[model samples]
Target: MLVYFRLLSESFRFAMNALRNNKLRTLLSLLGVTIGIFSIIAVLAAVDSLDKKITKDLSSLDKNTIYLMKMSFGPSEIPQWKREQFPNVKYDEYLYLKGAMTNTDQMGYQIFTKSESLKYGSNTVTSVNVVPVSHEFIDIQGLEFDEGRFYTESEANSAAPVVVIGNEIAKSLFEDSEPIGKKIRMYGQRFTVIGVLKKQGSGMFGNDDSSAFIPVNFVRQQFGDNNKGLVNVIIFKPEKGVDMDAYKAEISQKLRAFRGVKSGEIDNFFINVFSGFTDFIDGIISQMNVVGWIISGFSLLVGGFGIANIMFVSVKERTNLIGIQKSLGAKNRFILFQFLFEAIILSVIGGIIGLLLVWIIAMILTKALDFEFVLGMGNILLGTGLAAIIGLISGILPAISAAKLDPVEAIRTGM
Candidate 1:
């Protein structure tokens, strides 16, 4: 054990000496490994961060939550023309489902409409996302409030001129003043702000921070109940441990009956499950992982070749020293380990530099974009382990050659 430790120590010193003596050559040789590590680690970090953010953004809602709408969230066999001709989900249907659906934990109705400008006195914010939803939306989506509260059921039913603003909208429109109870102008009318959502950072879909929520009834009043452009959806959260397939069947049958659809006709509306959407996201992440590995694998191959070249050169340069050590009763294993450790040290150092660069860039991106970029322990360990493996693979042949060299022949050749 002590001898092995001494061998490692001596190898480390030799590796340092190589770096010190041939700085430019060493750097050039390690460049491929550095870039390879950087490419792989950067891609992995980005994918991980994206996955985490998506999960965090959707964490508040149950995965079993379902959206019933004219459009499908995932790819569908239905053509666009047929989907377009399909009637929009109406308030009556939402009411019917809300009251009639069994095995349901909660349900809400919402409308997706065009972006609208909001005015608070002389201050104006343009192109803000307008989400007109029922009071039940708060419970269904599990929205958190920074101040005040969501509209009451009565308020939503009555189409009251009250609004809930997101954090960015509140900050932009009201500045330092308390936003609650402040009236904002939209749809050519004054609406009082009743709630402010917590600051949710940028997301994959869109930032919720610059959005405003109002009563769906208000939207119905303005756009009328049958407005073709006003897309409506009914969201449902199923009870925990319930059979999703059975629940979906129940929903389909009820809606088909409610819509007076006859047998053998396809259902007009689509039922999109949140879990299906997450599965789509997972597929995308997997594709990204495959692409990252393929691209980075080339770099690693080049890096391996570079390390092998350097190891061969190292063997040639230290032939005399190796011969002397063997003449002094040093074993074959000692000579092999000496070169092997030097190669591993070189690769690991390059990998460390690459990781450091990734960390710095992650910090910069997190601050600049206001999105958290996580570099987890697992990824770090994976990177280091890959580097070590690359080192070992690249060093093996050279180490063996060095170990097998005849002492007298090696000494004579070096002289």
Candidate 2:
């Protein structure tokens, strides 16, 4: 151990002297390593921030709730067959499911139809999303009204033209006016506003406060196709003590029966529970990990090659010093360790400097992007390990040549 420490110290001293003598070359060699390490750190910081953001967004949904929808999470190039496979869920079927389910505390159906233009006085907003929902929608979504109450069941049944505006809609239409009792026009039809939702910011792709709410029947009357209703999603909160998996199984069977699917046939719809969404998110993160690691590895590979080139040049420059050491009765292992240690120290220092740079960049990114930079012991260890590996591998051939040198022959050749 003592010998190893002595050799390591000597190696660092020799490597520093060589670097000082060839300052420009040393800097050039280190450039590749710097860029590679920087890329890795930047990616880790950005991805970590996005991960936290996604987790926060998803946490707003109750763990016990399940979503019944036509689609799943994560980007897919496959085109959706929204109309053919899963026809829009009907209002009667939603009611039937609610009545039939004994394992749910609350159940709600949502239907959304977007009007391209919504106007208040002279100002207009385009591509405004309109959602029509039952009072239970709030319960299932775990939402509390910020202003007036959610519309009553009687209002929903009577197709009352009362609307609830989201924060953005309220701001756009009413500005400073008291939004309650105010009227807005969509597709030339007028609706009275009864409430306004508080601001909930953007998550993933869509903004939370991007839609206006109205009673289900009102939406059906205004926009429903053939009076059959076109429900987009069904959300349900599980009752206490009910096993979610069992509930899913029972619900699947019931829905299959309702839809008249054969035992051999796959159900056209999907059921998304808390775990399903988490699993989907995990899959996406895993893919990102693959891409990140691949890019980082490639960069390290290039840096490793640069280190090898510099080490080869270093061995040639130090040939006479190696011969002198051999003449003084140094062992081959000693000479080999000297060169290996020098290379390792150089790579390690470069790695540390790169790590520091990336960490600072991460901090800047976190502040600018509103993301958390998750730096820990693992990342530190990884950077150190990578540096050592690059140095050892790059120095191997040069160290071997130096150790095998014949002192007499080296002196006689004098080159």
Candidate 3:
């Protein structure tokens, strides 16, 4: 064990000396490995970060949440003209589903509206996302309050002029002052600020920090049921551990019967399950991973070739030294292991530099953008493993050639 350790130490010293003496060559050799590590690791980090954000955004909602509407979340067989001809989902339909649907935990009615401005005395917030939803939305969306509370069911049913503002809107309009019981103007009507939403950063749906929710019935009362500007949807969150297929079937059948659609005819509305939408997103992410790996694999290939080239050159330069070591009875395996370890060390050094670059940029971008960029431990381990494997493969043949050198012939040639 001691003899082997001494041999390893001698090999380490030799490898360091080579690096010190051939600075330019060593740098040129490591450049490919560095770029390759950077390329592969960067791609992995980006995809992983995106996946994390999506998960975080959807964390509060049950994966089985259903959207009952006319528009499909994914590609559909229905033609554009046919889908256009379908009637809009109504408030009555929402009430019917809310009452009739079984195996359901919660259901809420909501209307999609265009961006509108809100006014509080002199301070005005422009282009605010105005979500008009029923009182049930509070439970369905799992909304938490920073101050005050979501509108009561009676307030929604009566179409009362009460509003819940997002954290950003609250800060902009009121600053340090109390916002509850204050009045704001929107749609040419005075609405009392009854609630304030907790600060949620930018998300896939929209930033809760800059959005507001009002009673869905309030919009219905103002525009009537036939308002062309509003798109109505009923959100359903099913009970956990229920058979999903049967649950969706039950929803479709109930709507079909209520609409008087013939058994042979296709249902006019879309049943967009939240889980299905996420599965579609997952498929896209998988494709991105494949494409990224293919592109980065080319960089790694070039990097491997560069390392191999350097190892061959090193063997040639130290031919006389290798010959003397063999004459002193150094084992072939020792020579092979020495070269292999040197190659691995150099490759690992390059990989570390690449990882460091990723970490620094990840921090900078996270600060600059609303989205967070993460370089997880799994990716770091993967990068290191790839570097070591490249080194072992690249160094093998060169190490073998050095180990097999004829000592007498090598010494004479050196002279």
Residue 171 CA displacement from its true place in model 1, Å: 2.4
* lDDT by residue (tens digit), candidate 2, 243-278: 888999877888888889799877677777866777
Full ranking by lDDT: 1, 3, 2
Best by lDDT: 1
The digit string of per-residue lDDT tens for model 1 on 265-372 reads: 999999999999999999999999989999999998999888889999999998998899999999999999988998998888878878888899999999898788
lDDT, candidate 1, equals 0.91
Q: In candidate 1, what residue range of length 10 has the lowest lDDT sum?
A: 199-208
lDDT of each: 0.91, 0.77, 0.88
What digit string (tens of lDDT, one per residue) describes model 3 on residues 1-415?
A: 9877877687667667767998888878888888889888888999999999999999998889999998898899999999987777999988898889998998999899899999988999999999999998989988989999999999999999999999999999998999999999999999999999999888977888898899998888878877767788889989989898899899999999999999899989999999999999999888998888898888778888877888888888888888888789888888888888777777777778788888888999999998899999999999999989988888889888888889887777666
* TM-score, one value per model: 0.95, 0.80, 0.94
Please state the error at residue 280 of candidate 1 in Å: 1.6
Q: What is the lDDT of residue 346 in candidate 3?
A: 75
